[model samples]
Structures are given as structure tokens and as C-alpha cells.
Target chain A: MTYWDQEKECMARDNLEKLQLRRLKETVFRSYAFVPAYRAKMDAAGIKPDDVNTLGDLQKLPFTTKQEMRDNYPFGLFAVPMSEVVRIHASSGTTGKPSVVGYTRKDVDTWADLMARALVSAGADKRSVIQVAYGYGLFTGGLGAHYGAERLGASVIPASGGNTQRQILLMQDFGSTHLACTPSYALFIAEVMHDMGIDPAGLKLKAGIFGAEPWSEQMRTEIENKLYIKAYDIYGLSEIMGPGVAIECPFRTGLHIAEDNFLVEIIDPVTEEVLPEGSLGELVITTLTKEAIPMIRYRTRDMTTLSNGECPCGRTHVRMQKVLGRSDDMLIVRGVNVFPSAIETVLLGIPGVEPHYMIILERQDNLDIMEVQVEVSEDIFSDEVRKLEDLHKRIAKELESNLLISVKVRLVEPKSIPRSEGKAVRVKDNRKI
Target chain B: MAKQISVFLENSSGRLAHVTRVLGDAGINIRALSIADTSDFGILRLIVNDPDHAYKILKDAGFTVSETEVIAVRMPDSPGGLADVLDQISEENINIEYLYAFLGFAGGDALVIFKVEDIKKAREVFEKKNINYVEAQDLYKL
Candidate 1:
């Protein structure tokens, strides 16, 4: 029932926008002065930091794309020197090269504050025992949740990911009350609990914070029912400093962006024009206080609309609808973003596989399943069954390792997949989303 | 050395009929058939007159098809007839992958198709036991 930062969370709309304007000007000035990419973009657009005076003039800045992040690569976009930056994380993608981000010591503190605010908003408190199940290392979900739980004064269990059996055991033994991980993984944990004959009621779990993937409302209901916990959706991207950008309050209508730290805008993805309020379009964000890697109008490509409704929970920041889908052909399978081009790159790297391939996405038991169907060269098909099966397993294993999702690799006959005359259709998403 | 056509099918409505329709349009007559299904997919096995042609046509129609050699054995149309042949094959350590019954002479005798690990070994076992066996060409005519 308590708010982490009540003043900021429930500020008046005018006051909130004023604070945002101040931070926006400072962030733009820093990005333009320190980061060459932002400088070049502003130069091209003939815009200056003072030009972004009111939030209305934010449209004049050029948009930043994912390709620009890739073009900058490792440390090209950092606003601070490496010595001042304390930690780094990167977005997972199919390009083999990731979009790297850095966080200074103060930036890390700000991230923890926002995450704590998110947790407290979702009804987590100091007494709650948090179990972080997101993968650790380069991915931000694990460490992001860990720091927030620590800052909230909760007993943190840094149970990174995998080892579901042990995770269940710890959940019971540690008296874990909060779970932090992807929604699909939460379902998988529930399945493992059922397999182990453990009842959700027997555990002391009270709530769960699930993110790092786009999950449906039906999935949230399933997780809540199976895990006997109030499942809340958390949204973030590595480019925007990972999973605590926005989260659903207890009311659960939509996610409330941490507007004090990041500014949000909805723009027409194609025409590069900002859409009106409450209309669905691609999301763009400008980092307000991030000094390490401040991004100016970074295009998220995630499609969602904005809501300024006053929440019953009293948070006055704008709420964003849960992301519907990407403007591009990025498929999220079991919490991992899989690009058809990434699959194609891996497939083309291996021998005996044709360039032709199809990615089939299906939903089975409220979980996402991705199957890669690739054509096998005639010579490979003519080989013995054992050899062919080995190849199949090999491709599946390789893809699973690279994509971080279990993939079922099917080898079809050569030239069997229907070839299109223009723009090969590589993905067939059968999910009702 | 009888040939059995096996088609992979998704467990959905109209999929089986679609396969049969494709075969029917191609002038391929199915003599005997059975389907083995799981929750996700099914494998349709058929004893057709021309397996190579049927396989080609089914493949061309966008269905996954494969051919396997099966031996046809004539057994008494009564209890323990199948058990007798299975006992013999089991004694010889010849694994029977699958088997199905087919009509023959309307009650005089019944033809049982057996797909085994080793077709030659199965034929030799049937020959040693003096069990009646139908040749592939004669079975096709029937």
C-alpha cells in the first residue's frame, strides 16, 4: 500500500511535465555534447538542445533506429567514459552482434530506484522474499531485478535461470513471496511444480513480476491461477535500461511509465510522424537522466498506445498499453526475441541446408513454440536416416544455443516450401495476438 | 517385397480425405490402409497398387511421403492366427515394426501385412515354417 517515491509517482500533470522538460533538456544537451551519434543526428535535423524546450517540440529531433545502435556497436554511443561507467548490458538479437549499453554508478542507482518503485507499485515490500529467475550475465532481467529487490530491503534470492527443480525447492525453503522472470518461464515453473506434485497453495508466494517478453492477458490469468500469485507485467528494453521502465499498478489497466526518468512518445512508424494521444503506433523514448548512455528519441519499434487516465492507485504518469507487436518481423518465443533473419544467418552458415526456410510459431498450452522448417539438400536427404536425424538434432541444438529458446528443427524435402515471387515470407505466426 | 506408402499428416479435419482425394485423382487405388495417430500428428499407411507412382504424386501434392517394404502373409481367419505368426517372428528375433489385417477370399484366408526390421529374414522365417506368403505382384493384382 506504500509508494516508494510518492512525490514523483503522484505529482500533478503540470509539475510532472515540468520535471520531464527539465530532464529532457539536460539529457539532450548531454547527448548532443558527448555522443557523436546524437550530435550527428541533431546536426542533420538542424535541431539544438534548446529547441526541445517544451515537450511539444520533441518531434523536431531525428529518430534513432536499431540499425544505428548496431552501427555504433560496442562503445560508440556511450556519453560517459569507461572509467565512470560501472556496468554494461546489451540487447539480445539475431545479428550475432548486440546493441551494447553502459551505466554509470549514478545511472545504476537511478535504475535501482525505478525498479524499486516498480516493485512497490506491484505490492512488493521490504518483507517480501524475492526470487529472481531471469537469466544473468549480458541479459538485464536478472541483475535488474536483483538490485531492485535489494534496494527495496527484501531478501533477494539471485536464482538466475534454469534448474527449475532447484528453483521450486528454494521457493518453498526460502519462503519466497515474489517471483521475477518471464511469463513463459513462470508457466514452465508451474508445470514443473505440477510434475513434482507440489501445490501452489503450499508455497508462500504472494506476487510475481514477469517481463522480458510480450505476454497476453490470458497468460497472466493462467500464471495467476496456477501460481496462486498476482502476476504483474513489467516492460523495458536493454536500450532503455532494461526491465523497470514501466509496470502495472494494482489496478492492472495499463503500465505506468516512469515518466520522471524517461519520456515516452507514440509515433507513426512509417511516416516518422507523432500520432495523437491514445492512438497505437511505434514507441519512442528519450532518456532523461541517464548519463552513461543517454538515447534521444530512440525508436523502440514496439507498437503500443498511450493513456493519460488518472489511475485509482494515484500514479499521475501516462500509462502505455501492453505492446501488441513489433513493427518489424521480430518473434518472441519463450522470452527470446528471434528474428527470421537470425535464423537464416545461422542456417546459411551451416552446410547441407538450403537458404529456403520457414519459421512457424504456435501456441501450445499457453506457451510459445517456435519450429524452424528448413529444406535439406537432396544429397543430405539421400543420406542414412541416422545421419539425417543427427543433422536435425545438431541444427536444433545450435539454434537453441544461439537464440536461447528450444527450437524444433524439421528437415523437409528440397523445394517443398512454397516459394513466393517477391519478398519471401519467412514467418507464419499463428498466435491469436 | 511389398511396398507400403506412409504419409505424414497433421491431426486435423479433412487432412485424411485430402490425401485420399489426391491419390484418387492420380488414379491410384488403395487396396488396404490404416492410420496411426498421436495427439499432434498422424501417419497414414496404405497398401496401394503402385507405390512409386503414389509416392511421387503425393509428394508433388505437398504431402510428406515415404515407402517401406512389408511382407504379406496368409493366415487363417480365426483366433490365434495372428498370434501364431507373431510368435514365429518373435522367436526368430525379427522385430515387427507394425502389422495390419487385410481381406482375402472372403473367409477362406486373411492377408496380414507385416513391416519388420529385416524383410529378407521375415520371408526366410515364413518359408522355413511353410507359411503361405503372397508375392508383391500378385497382391497388387488383388
Candidate 2:
């Protein structure tokens, strides 16, 4: 358990807060002074850099959002000149225009150091061979993990996303010890390995850092069992700092955030007010050390809670639970709020239900109807129609009792659900309204 | 005990066509077929010349196929032929889950497939009542 930066990682809580405050003030002042878009926003809200004397004053600043990023488009909120910006990454922007994020030379270095700390916490060392399977180029996952693994002095194989067979071959031939990719992609890779007849035990893969999509703990167990590796949940977005914002330690406990670099707050998404510690709500982050684009209180839309205590790993940073689901992913069906992850938890516990599912929402008679189409795998399929119907009823019954909402369970053909190379599409809203 | 191939099919178009194409390509002839469908999916019950072969090919083609035991009976080809056969079974208190028509091996007679609640007991009643039913091997040769 050698720390990447033992002094910074294990600093006292009071000292870390002091460091965060200093960086917060500098980031506030720089954003107000260099970026006019942020300055106008602050002026409209009656907030000045000089007024942010304490950390709690962070709530006074207007929150930046994903929609604001797209409105700014490209680089409207960059706090530094283009000469200092050395790297750029944009989210896939499943909606319309991609939200762009820039990294200055110093910001990129800070990102690499933060990612290295995350990797170290998740049990990586200079001797480890890390295979970064995340997509490179405009997507932050690939290059983010690449630089972090390199910073940790570990051997990095830049095996970007999508060549599943070749990735498996390289993972075996290169003696890769760690894999970095989305959890859904990792599951698909495991499926490919099964088809390729490549035994996971025959490979040197040890642990996996999976993020970029919300997944359940049962999903983690499936990946761990399928790949024969420890699956660590990582939390990050390009709006924040890609795949290294926070990650679970080797103990598989809550994810530890680098408090010195990022300030985390859980806020009620509806009221937009910060909640007390350990309350699950939408995550809002204020980057304290980023140089290229100093985001002030960015509403991440991810739902999770923060807990403060000394981790067994000896780090004092606050830990966030594995994200429940994005507020944007929550579906309101028939007046009952439902999280797709809740449906996933139910599906995972039942037999004959594969992890592949698609939630189709429709409006009939001006009422919301949620139909969960579950893939029928070879194991769950039966020639007996009654048996198959019973499985379908079981899923629907369990979902309604568990989620307290009436759900329609549809048994789909085996492998009928479509999966993208990136995040798997879990929901499809077909309501014209 | 006769083997009938039961395949799970989605109600989406072309799936049934695909299954039939796969079985036809394998040189398996459909002797008798019945489809039980819902709004979302269907169960295509098939009585074929080669039940084992049809099941294997459909399974390989990625269709969820299964084999179940059903009784094939040779009844009179009159208007009341089905009623007479079903009346005797009802008299013995045997519950028939479902029954479908099938092509007969010979002319002037009708072949019926019976999926009942109690198959072994049905066989006993059939034997005691002097009913004519095709043997499992004889039915597969149709």
C-alpha cells in the first residue's frame, strides 16, 4: 500500500481544508478575472472573489451545469490562454452538442497526479502492467487513464476501446495486470472472452477500474466473477476531471475523493440546496486546483452521499458511496419516481434474467407505462411456455413490490437488446410527449 | 410418448420465417404445426418427421426449442371424429391441456396430437378403452 503522494493523501483534515480554501479562492479569483462569462454570472448573483473567504462561502457562487457548458460550447469558460492549454477532451454528449473541457499544461499534470493517486489507492504499483481499454482521442477515459498509469510508473498498454478480440489478445500477450474501461464494456469483453474460449485464469489480469456509467454492486460481483479480478468503482466525468476524480481503495469500500483538489457536496436536485453530510443527493463539485477551466460548483447530476472518517487505508479524504444513478436517468412512470438502477438490482437477483435490459416508456391515455424488456438467455429459456411465463411474472411481481410501482415485464429474445461500444443504453423513452 | 418440438419465437416479423427456413434447410419436414402466440411472443409447437433433428437445428439457429411428449391418435375421418375421441378421454376424467390436428400416415383417417395433464395415465386409459393411437416411433416416421 505505498501511497502516490503520502503527504498529500494522508494530510490532517484541518490542513487539507486549509489547502482547499486557498485553492478555491485562487480558482474563484482567476475565473472571475480571466473568463467574462463567469464574471458576468458572478456579478448578476452579487458574488465577488473577495467574499469567498471561507470554504462554506462556496455555496454562494452560482453553480455551473452541463447545459451551461454546451451553451458556452468549445472554450467559452477557459480561465487561461490557449497557449497554456495543451489537451482537450469532450464528452460523447449522448444528447446533442458535446460539452468540451480543456486542460492546461499544469492542469494536465495535476490531472495525471490525481489519477495516479486514485490508481495507487486501488492497488497499482510501478510493477503493474495496466491495459487502458477506455476510448482515446476526444473521449477523456482513454488518455486520462493512460497518463495516470504512466504517472504511477506502471507499464501502460494503450489498448483503446472496441477491438474486443485484440484487446483480449494484448491483455494476455502483454501480461497486463489491470484493466481500465467502462463496466458495461468490461462485461461485454468478458462475454467475448467466453466466446473466444479464453479462460480468464490463463491471463495475468488482476483488477479492473470500471466507470463512465452507473452500475450496481451486483454488477460488480458479476464482473469480478466473470473476469476473475477485483472490480473497483471509479467516479468521474470530463466536466470534472475524467476517470480519476475518485475511486475505491483496495478494501472495496466507499470511493475516496482527493479533497485537496476537488470540493464535493451532495445537494437536493429539486431544491438545488446542499444537503447535510451522508445524505444521498445530486453531486456538486467545485474544482479547487484545475488551471485550464476553473469550474465553480459544477452540478454533476450524479446521486451519492459523502461520509467523513479515517479510512482503513490511512487516507483522510471524504468517501462517496457508489453512485445510485444520475438524476437525468431517473424515470417518472405513472407518477412514481423510479431509478433504472433499482430495476437493475431487481433483475440481477432473479434467475434466468440476463444483465441486458431496456426500459421502454410509453404514454397511453396520458399515463406513463414502464415496460422493462429483459433478455432471455440460454439458461433461463424453457420450451415450456408456462415456465417462461412464470419467469416473466416473477420479474414483474418482484419489481412492483421492490420499487412500489406497477411495471410491465417483457421477455425479449436472447441477445435482442442492443449494446453500444460505450455505455449500454438502459432506457428508451418512446413517448411522443 | 411422442416428441414434439416447441420453439419460443418473438412476435416480431421474420422470426418464424427464420425458424422455418432453418428447419427446411436441414431437410426436416413439418408434419403438423400449431402456433400459440401472444402480443409480445409466440410458442410454435411443431410435429415434424424428425423431431430430434428439428430440435437440434432450431436450437443451433438460436431459437429456444424444447421436446415434450404428446400422444398422436388415429381417429375416424367423420365430422364427429374429434368429438368421439375427446368424449372417451373426458369420460376417463383425463384433462387435455391442448390438442391440434396432424397429417396422418395413411388416407381415410385423421391424426390428432394431444397434450394432456397426465400423460402416463392417459396412455393407460387409451389402452384399456381399445383406442387407436400411433406409437412414438411410428408417428416420427410420418
Candidate 3:
């Protein structure tokens, strides 16, 4: 199950640098010759493929944002003809239009190769029976992990998301060796397994690949303790060819980016000035080897930093810190940028309230107010309106102190809110744009 | 033939007690009661001595209420007593979603409040079996 290019896969800094330059040159020349839009952009920037002879010359290119990608819509930025596209995946459009990405057969193979490498880097091997529970279709998380497990010569059970009972049954029956899904879903699966009186350790899951949404290190430790498995973070975006753009090795230091195929950059989002390495800034990427839709300096809007220091693991690829937060997803509550993850941390720390809650934002009298509706356990309090109001006030005061914003709290009964199998929608913004 | 009245109440606290107090003050006795709640609201099912009067009293007090026909089957309070009634209903292909029960003091009779899919068919089964059913007046005495 070893890679044919094992030496190349673990290339040293000098060798990796040479490999990247060759790939970058090929990609730029291909794009300038084939893609009219890319050629026009390069022409307007007064830059040519021959001009980008060194890595330092990448800044001469223009940056691509999610809004720009969405504005172009489907197949608009394809470097190759539409006939060469083998697959297309899109992001979940919570705010506006979803960003669409197209891939050629070669691009798909490269994606699977990187994903397989990622899994192997995370200790997966041929003996592993990987159970993929990410949502399938349109979204890349499921298929991306699926192909990787297959490529790694592992026994892959593509048990897509939801059907918790059936998922548990398969995990037990098939003795799944690896679990892949969102961190929240992994915890949810563990909860269901406990409720069903099934020991998660007995199911034979040895490791997990959790991604698709950002999770905290506290949550990672909690999940690892509960599932009794080593959890690795796999990062990717559909716009960047799905899951396997980067992955965390066993060192758990940071995700190692496949810089040979993709060049990573950190830029100040407001000023568009590229930041020095190790500086936290918006993550921007450029696909050096992709053919169908070769993105040049695509602004991910995700905040993180790049590290060139050698990892404890012998790999020489650059490392990226876990995504802190999405700039677009940040909520400006009374002039303070608040992320939902921050609220989740404070909420989970509180007693008497379940993790399931909703933050409703409404504008009243030209001022924005947030209402947090938390589900209380049946034993928490008696069924008295006054007692419920008192509990609500307590929760409101606690939230106000933690979030630094006044929040109206409402105590709801258990199972009052709807459950989601994919990304959980916790915030509802009703203010006028 | 016991009378049944449906009481609508908001899911706030002490609402059930308030409704019970109104019936207790009027000197009207409650034979049996069942409550269904969806958290935000609740429907109180009552089998009373006089359902029409109870409904009017609650309605006059600005409470939303209604009256619906529910079977009041009288069975022997011994082994296989309720099973006999259910067996008869099942034999006639009547579906019983839920039911409530109260044992009579004579040690031989019991009253069952049943919410069935087909009320007419259930009543026919009881009538054909010659089962003694309680009337509204009998409930008032209890």
C-alpha cells in the first residue's frame, strides 16, 4: 500500500521547492494558453508566466474572493474546456451564493491521492476499515474521504450521514476501524451509542477524521476521550478540490499543506497586504496543478497562519494552523464581532442547559437584540411560569457577563428544537442588511 | 354513556389546578381525566357527571372548550377483564390508539376511557356482547 513516489511524497525542503517550481510553471503556462479569463487577468496585471520564475513573484497575481467566485458562477473559471470536467461540488450557501468548483479526471485523481496521503499521515493503513459518515452528494466531504480510503487500500464503508441507529449497527457489525465525520456528529454518535448501551470501544474504531466545520481544541480532547480514538483534523474546501488540501499528522501540531500542488498565502483582508509567515491573516490559496478550474490566489476568508518549521513528523510540506474563524460568518453584535463558536463555548460551560440552543437576532428601535433560547432538562426545574422566568433571567445575566452583550434568554422544554444531521444552524439574523 | 368534555389550556403552570377548582366549586364530580400536552399548549380530556354544564361554565369563564364522544366501557375487575374488551375490539378490526382506566369499588366492575379509531364499531362490539355501559347519571353518582 506504499505510494509509488514515496520518496517524492516525503521530499526534503530543496527537492520540494524544485518540485513546486516545476508544477507552478506548468500550471501558469497551461492557464495562460487555455483559460481566456485567466489570461486576461494576467495581462491586466502586466504579469506573464515567464515572470513568475520564483515563489516570490506570486504576489504579482490578483486575489480571488468567495464573492468573485460566486459572481462567476458554475464553470466560469474553468481553465480547461467544460467537456473535461468530471465532477462539480459546491459550498453550502448560508449567506449568499454558493461557491462552485469543477474538477477534471486528473484533478479528481490528485484529490484522492492527497486524501489517501492525509489518511496515511494520520496512521490509517490497509487494515483499516474506514466508516465515512459525512453527508454525501454536492458536498465533497463524503466522497473525498471515501476515495481516499479506497486509494489507501482500506476497507471503506460509505455509511453517509444520519440514520444514527443504522450507523451504530454498521459500526458494530462491520467492526469499523476508522470513523470520519464532523466533530459534533462524532460526539452525537458517541452519545447515541452510549444511550443504546453499546460500548464505543467495542466497535473497533481506532481513529477519526473530523472536519467540514471548525471545532475547538477542548472539543477535540472531549471527543477523543469519549470515542477512545485518535482524532485528526482534515481541512479542505470545495473551491479547492474538496477534503485533502491539508491534514494534521500524528504530531497534532498543525495541518501540513500539500504545497507542491497548492501555494498558500496569508493576507490582511482589509488591506490585501500579504502578511509574513507565522502572522495570523486570511488564508488565500492558488492551485498550481489543477486543470478544470485552476484558482489563482483564491481568498479563502478563513483566518489562519502558515509555518515552515520542520514538523516532528519527517514531512517537509508547510503547516497551517487550524482555522480560527470565517470572516464572513462573524456576527457584529452591537459593534463587537462575535463568532457562534464563542457562544457555544460559554453555553456548553453552563449547567442545566443542553448543548442544543438557538440565538435569534432581531432589530428593535434601531438597536439589535439577541435572544438565546436554551433547552432545559426536565429535572432542572418545576413547570411553573415564574420559576422559568427566574431561570431565564439567570441565564441572561450569565450570558451577558460572558459575551459582553445583553442577551434575552428563554427556557424551552427538551426536544423543543429541531435536530440537524449536517451543519447545525444556531444563529438567526433578522436585522436588515 | 358518561359525558366527555375537552378543555383547552395554555401550557403555563397552575392552569390545570384552576380548571379542577372550577368543577370542584360547582359540585360537579369528575369521573376520569386525561391530559395531552405539546409543551406550549395542553388539551385536558374529562369524563364528568354533566359535560354540557361543565363546558358552558368553562366557556362562560373565557376558556376554550369542546365536547366529544368517548367510549366508557364497563368490564369485570378480575383477570382478563380488560383483555376481553380489547380482544373483542381487535376481532372486529377496531384500532385503539390509547385508553385510560378506573376500577370500580364493587370488585367486579371497571370503567375504561378509550380513544379508538372507529367509535361506532367499538360501541357495536360492546352492545352485541351485552356489556353494561355507564350512563352520565351513573357517573354523577360516583
Candidate 4:
């Protein structure tokens, strides 16, 4: 009924810098007293807590990585005691072991507030009925959005992903005003809504907060066009905090990082040297106000840039560009580095193959061969073996032209490939190396 | 010589039409045909009047057409004829993946399309027993 975007932070540069310095000092001191690992790292660098007097000295601190967190495992680096932790969330461990993160009661409240701030930034208010369709449980997206909507004093509908028909039915019956889920699922929901003959524009929904997977601007435009709502991007890693670490304002320029709670830095991915603003590199985050599992200069592996320039929506918190790709997820195919997201963009633009597909890399005779198994739907007319074979050849040729690498194409039945409610696994490398 | 071409197809509506259109354009006449379709992918087995020519056309058109050996057994349309042939193949330890009758009652005999584990052994057994084998010309006529 009513829409009110939250007031954006518009502090002057000098004042914001002073605030960040003060917070950085408190964070270093707290880490020295509570987090022994960080204290040890700082001591090894021959620096004391008092030595980091300014933000410029942050570069002197040792950088943490996902591997480091995994090496510590479970609760090894938790700054607070077990009694202080009220909740836990874990990253989807498709590559290796799952990295676990803990939250104290205050930390949970902080996460809720940040998520609520994200919802408000997307133009939701207390009168809005929010539907959170992200996966619940160990995955943070659902609860992160759930608590955030609740904190906004809105009517929170904890839909929690899957069962498209039911999700749509609730959307219609409950008059849900806000949606929170992965961008892919949001598009799928839009498709379902169209099939059900429910006009998405007529729905009470005003905005959507989509994340959990890297999506393109094309996908954002597609989802917004289909759903008829203003779409926003919410960014966070469970290791740092849940989905509220940063969010896109109405301008959709870049995600404004919660500088008061998290300090963001960009460094050359290969060289590990800190880069000037606007230069794309690996994103490094340091939790400035977290109680449990307080991290110092954690290398996120996410590729993006940080800018302190004021956004049109007026959030002065340092903004990060939309994540281009993940460093670890890049695939080296025939000496050419390829990201699955790039492949996804190409696949979605093609007409024949459905969105569901699998890229399999296998070693054959000391050479890596890429095989793409695409799902064929009713749109494809060929049922005869010869015709199907011809289609496969055509698709392979198209992909070869686009990717600049030869690939074999296999047509599979719809829904044959495995589906995931969380992060979908698109690339499967069977190569021993 | 007649050609036997194997095609890979997914089972769906209008698929047969699309495949027929390609062969029809190439001026190839199907003497006999059979299908081995699962829920996922299907294999279309065809014996064309002009085997070599049809195989080239389909292959050059980017179809994964492979040559396979299939037997053409002539049997009476009555009930015991197919049962007897199956029993004989079973005794010879030859497994039949799929089979279909090519010619109808106009020929007074049914042509059974068959795939066996060992084509040589199955042919030998059929030959030694003097089972009537349908010729390519006779099949085209039917």
C-alpha cells in the first residue's frame, strides 16, 4: 500500500574516513584481545594493534582466504565463545569442504538490520508483504532475507524456494509485495506466473532482491521485464556475514557495502598488491564490527572494484561493482580461461537449447575435450535419430564459434540433469588434472 | 547393394516427419525401418533401396549415420511363424534387441527385421536351416 525507500548514508568524505579509521582501530584492538589467530598474524607481521592508526596501514595486515578458513574449520577462528554463538551458516561445498560461519545474538541482530536495510533500499516498507524464496537451513539466503523483512516490520512470508506452483499460488493468494531469491529462480517464477495466466504487473510486488548466483545485466533486464518489478542485487558471503553485507540501491549502479560493519579492499588478483579505486581485482573484506568469527582482510576471490563516489541513491558506503566472475570458478579449457557465467550468457541467447545444461570436461589421449549436454524441450522438432544428430552438430558448431574452442554436443531429455535448490552445479570436470 | 543406416533420435512429436523430409529430399526410398527408443534417446534403423547413396547424403548433412548388419527373415503372417524364428534364434544364443515386419500380406510373407549379437553366426544358422531371406528388390516391391 505504501512505499518508502530507506534514507541512504550521505556522510562527507572526511567524516566517513574518520569514522572508518576509528572503527578500524576498535576492530584491530578487539581482534588482538579476542581472536588469537588474527593477533598471531599481526604479530608475525611485526605490527601491534596500536600500529594500525589509519586505514592506509590496513595493507600491512596479512590477508585471509577461503582456504585459510577451511584450514581452521568449524570453530577454530571463532572470536567469541561457543555460548555466544546463536546461529550458524555454511557455504555450499561443491568444490571441497564446506566453510562454516557462526553468528552471536548481536551478530544475528546486525545481519537482520543490514538485510532490512537492503529491503528498504529496494523500496519496501512496513505495509509490504515479503516472500523469501531462497533456500533455508545451513544456507544463509533464506534466513538472511527472512529476518531482514521481519526487522523492517513488514509481513514476512517465508516461502523458502521450490515448488513453483505453490510459490505462485501463495504469491497470488497472499498478495506478496516483495520477493527475495536467486535471479534464476526469479525468472523461473516469472515463467510459472505467465503459464498460470496471472499478470505479474497486477501483483502487489514492487521490488525484488536477487542474488546467490552471478547473473548478467541481460538476465537482470529479462527478469525485470518479466516480473514487472524493480530488481536489486544483494551481495554477501556466509564467511563474512549473510546476505546483508552490501546491496544495490534503486540506481542499480553498484552494491553499496555496509562500511560501518565491513571494510572492503581491492587487490590485484595475481600480484596481491592493493589497487587504486576503479581498478578491477579480487575483493578483500574485513569485518569491522562482527563478534563471532571476526575476519581480517579475507580474500573473497570475487572479482570486482570498489568506488567511494556518491551514488545517485545517496549511499556513501563504499560501493562495489557487480561481481564479474569468481577467480576459483574460472575454467581453463585448452589454455583459454572461461567462466561458466560467460557460457551461460551464450547458451541463454541461443534458441534451441533450454537453460538447463551441463558442461563436462574430460581428458582423452592427453587432451581435454569439452562436452556440453543440453536439455531438449518441445521447441526442438527432431525426434528422428538422423535429425537429432544434425541438430547436435549444428549446436556444436555454434558453440565452437562463440567459445573459440571445439566442443561436442549431446542432446538429453528435459529434467535429466541434476537440479539444485541452492547453487546449481553447471561445470563438471572429469579430468584428473 | 542395399544400405542399412543407423540414426540417433530423441523421441518426440513430429520427429519422424522431419527425418522423412530429409530422406525424401535426397530421393531415398525406405525399404524397411525399425526403431529402438528409450525415454531418453532413440536409434532409428533403416534399410534404404539405395544404401550407399542415402548413407552419403545423410552423413554429409551432419547426421551420425552408421552402417549396421540386420537380418531380413521371411515368415508367414500366421502366429507360429514368428514364434518359431524367435525360438531358433534363442537356441542359437543370439539376442534380438528389436524387430518389425517389413512386408505385409500382399507378399504372402512377413519380413522380420532383427539385430543379433553375432550377425555371422545368426546368418549361418538361418542359412543352414534354409530360412527364406527377403531380398532388397523384393522388400522395395513390398
TM-score of chain B of each: 0.93, 0.96, 0.86, 0.84
Alpha carbon deviation, residue A68, candidate 3 (Å): 3.0
In model 3, where do residues sit more than 4 Å from their true spots?
Answer: A1-9, A95-97, A349-354, A377-403, B1-142
- Worst lDDT run of 10 residues, candidate 1 chain A, spans A377-386
Global local distance difference test of model 1: 0.83
RMSD after CA superposition, every candidate: 15.3, 3.3, 14.0, 12.8
TM-score of each: 0.63, 0.89, 0.71, 0.72
Please identify which of the two predictions, 3 or 4, would achieve the higher TM-score against the true structure: 4
* Residue A132 in model 1: lDDT: 95
lDDT for position A22 in model 1: 92
For residues A297-416, write the lDDT of model 4, one tens digit per residue: 989888888888767776678889888778788788898777777676676676655567799999988898998888765456342444566676778877888788988777765555
Position A327, candidate 1: lDDT:
74
Which residue runs of candidate 2 sit more than 4 Å off their true CA positions?
B1-4, B47-56, B66-102, B106-140
Model 3 lDDT per residue over B1-142, tens place: 5557776555678889988999888876777887766545556778777788898787655465667666777888789988988887788888875677753442367878787667777777778988666665766566
DockQ score for model 2: 0.36
Question: Whose TM-score is greatest here?
Answer: 2
For residues A108-201, could you state the per-residue lDDT of candidate 2 as single tens digits?
8998998998888878999999999998889889999999999999999998999899999999899999999999999999988986789999
Q: How does residue B56 of candidate 1 score in lDDT?
A: 86
For candidate 4, lDDT tens digit of each residue in B19-127?
7788999898887787766555777778777777777786555454667667788888888999998888788788775676673443677777776667778888888
On DockQ, the stronger of 3 and 4 is 4
TM-score, chain B, model 1, is 0.93
lDDT by candidate, in order shown: 0.83, 0.88, 0.79, 0.79
Clashes of each: 0, 0, 0, 4
